[model samples]
Target: MSTATDLAELTARVRAHLALRHPDSPIGDLKTLPGGHSGLTYSVTAGDARYVVKAVPPGQRPVGRNDVLRQARVLGALAGSAVPVPAVVASDDRQPAWFAMDFAAGEAVEPVLDAPEVPAGTARARMLEIASVLRRLHGTDIRTPGLGAPEPLDAAGELARWSRTLHAVPAELRPGGEELLTRLADALPSDGRQPVLLHGDFRLGNVLCAGERAVAVVDWEIWSVGDPRIDLGWFLLFTDHRNFPHLGRAVPGLPTEAELLDTYRDGRPPLPAMDWFRALGRMKMAAIMGHNLRRHREGKHHDPDQERLPPTIAAMIRTARDLLA
Candidate 1:
């Protein structure tokens, strides 16, 4: 249960933990996994068994508590579903607050997104593959046991949820965020469909792709029951011109908003008022970034890149406003 700052200490702890839960397995070749803003990940081999351990940093308090346990629950919920998630092995919320899952081998699509040019066919295929995975995830029955009960969401609740958090942001950043939220609330979509489970942070970086196929969807901190279109909106907005105009030139292979929607909907009912949902997505990002900025200022989680978040928040606010206009 003690925290380990060095690999030697961590390896020893892993050996002890394994001896208790998995007596026959002996630890070897332990290494830290990379690439996540929050949570520490480690890869270990024990008697030919390979798995990953995800741990919350000692004093790091995420926006809504460290969600390692929730993440474990989510993986368990998706057990028999088509969605690809790492298999959870063990978890505990003490001291280090960690969980273990079968290790997935693949690179995240995040790096591919940074490529300046991707062959047209490759780009289209990758886009379709990603969209297919999303389609399956949403299609999974939320009424299943391990998955929590579905919670209905509407424009008002979404606004209030982010508004409460937005209030704490610096006064200078409040005007734009508030204005954008007001516009979103006014234009809220009236699509009358039951809520479906949503992958809250659905994006390239969050998905692990091996050989052009999405092998595993990582990071379940914000997953919840909500409007399914919001997931699509979130993805489309990232590629939208206003959000990051330079991205198209800097990084090719991104599907157009129309293409992604078509693939996701897959001849099902058409999405309702995409612009409004996209604006909401932008506002959500703004609120999150603003919250992170506040945390940075308060020295809650010391990240050097957090120094660059204010302008990003401002840009997101502007993009949200423009989406409404």
Candidate 2:
């Protein structure tokens, strides 16, 4: 078990701790992995074996996404599944709590496919592969060990959670959220589905890839079991640049939304209505942007890019309204 508290000190300390665990081992420098929110992620080595450690900030109680063990549980359950996941080597809940997983080697692809160094054809193939993998994930047996029968989606609660975030934002920033949300709540899809594990934020940005295939879906922090449409619709949004106007469109080689749907729906039953689901995904994303943008403008956080979100948020709500109409 590690006793280090300061995250900055972990580069050497984590390696030292692990080296003791695996004597005559861990010859490389430790790396602080990127993009995690508040959690401390480290790439450490032990005896020619590389593993990633996802930890709650040392000395604090794990709560919500900070609960690294919950992520470990999901990853552990998915280890041998068709969906790619790293293997959990260890986890500890005591102070400086963390879980270790064998490092799954692959490139962490960006959300904008065209930006990757790979050929456009490879990026296009990755999207189709993601669709294929997502379908298999949605079809995985929910009865799998460590995750039992999941609660059917609580549609009202889901809407309410995002509603609170929208309400928290300045009215101008969250333009038309009220109307979009109202229509979304009314058209909410059936809460019932034969539930399966959801990657929650399933998207190209969330996966690591090698040669048009996703080698691992790495973030399990928000994973839950519920209507698979929640995962599907959210992923489909990234294919179109309008959903993220600040990010600009480099969509030429990527699969169209219709084409991706065809890939995901190949063996499943005729697809259910997806318009409402798509609108709900838009509303949820807008709520998140509104809240974060407000925080940015208020100086609580300072991401200059969020200054551009007002129009993006407006467009999302406007489009959602049209979808509902």
Candidate 3:
């Protein structure tokens, strides 16, 4: 829904922000990147140097919602760490908002997710590596300033947030989703004391992979300090399927639930409420898909994959019920 004017204005704003941040770097032409619903992303060239600029919407920007700054801070904090996050060049947290960072050159991993040649073992290894990086990220001491205070939500708090989100979804989309939300809310767990930084959305789509290895982790808007299990749960929903026709060949690179847990825990204290958190994760995805489908139904957005959602939501509901049972 972005007009040429919107792109032009955003390009100008990003250019200005980059100039102020990197005065020496002579910026060249700018091009907008595709595949994002909430925020705007751009790829720019600066005198043979390339960088990416990420920014929220101009006028309707959400309060306390600056994804560019948040991502920059995360990358800055994870510097010298084992996590494979992008390196931030400069961050501008002011108005006409944007942040600049080195644009990763690798091909995005999304197109290959459904490819035939990409072996399951390769996918599994990358998933494990991602899990390890997440574990290390969560284990890091989160006392750094400018990264914002860590807010680790308990099960109840997560339920409330997702529940509110579901309510905000249109009534036409609420049929099967409301019951799933209720199931998660009623079955909320009481444990999970050790809180670490979470990637919020740690799915294959947000990662950039070259062959078998993950070169860089993209999309840090939802990154925050929370239960790490939430990340695992989200991944399972997107990648694991018992009903997909291509389940045997299509599902590669996935770790057993036990293996994923072992990698995440890595000899740390046992996560007693892991199942509860996983179920909550399924419910969360269902709500998100419902909202998107609602938008599509209302003619606000168009997605060819919208028709495939009802079954997916059903699968998530079944998965949540099975976990709770």
Number of the predicted model whose TM-score against the real structure is largest: 2
Q: Estimate each model's TM-score.
A: 0.83, 0.90, 0.86
Alpha-carbon local distance difference test for all models:
0.71, 0.77, 0.69
Clashing residue pairs in candidate 3 (N, C-alpha, C atoms within 3 angstroms) = 123-253, 124-253
- Poorest 10 consecutive residues by lDDT, candidate 2: 1-10
Q: Global lDDT for candidate 3?
A: 0.69
In candidate 2, stretches whose alpha carbon ends up further than 4 angstroms from where it belongs are: 1-5, 8-21, 27-30, 111-118, 148-150
Q: Could you give me the TM-score of model 1 versus the true structure? A: 0.83
Query: Which tens-of-lDDT digit does each residue in 204-312 have in candidate 1?
Result: 6677777677788888877887777778778775554346432323335567778888888889877777877787777777777777877877898777666666666
The number of the candidate with the highest lDDT is: 2
Q: How far in Å is the alpha carbon of 135 misplaced in model 2? A: 1.2
lDDT tens digits, residue span 7-45, model 3 = 687777667767775688887656778776556677897
Better of 2 and 3 by lDDT: 2
Residue pairs whose backbone atoms clash in candidate 2:
none
Could you give me the TM-score of model 2 versus the true structure?
A: 0.90
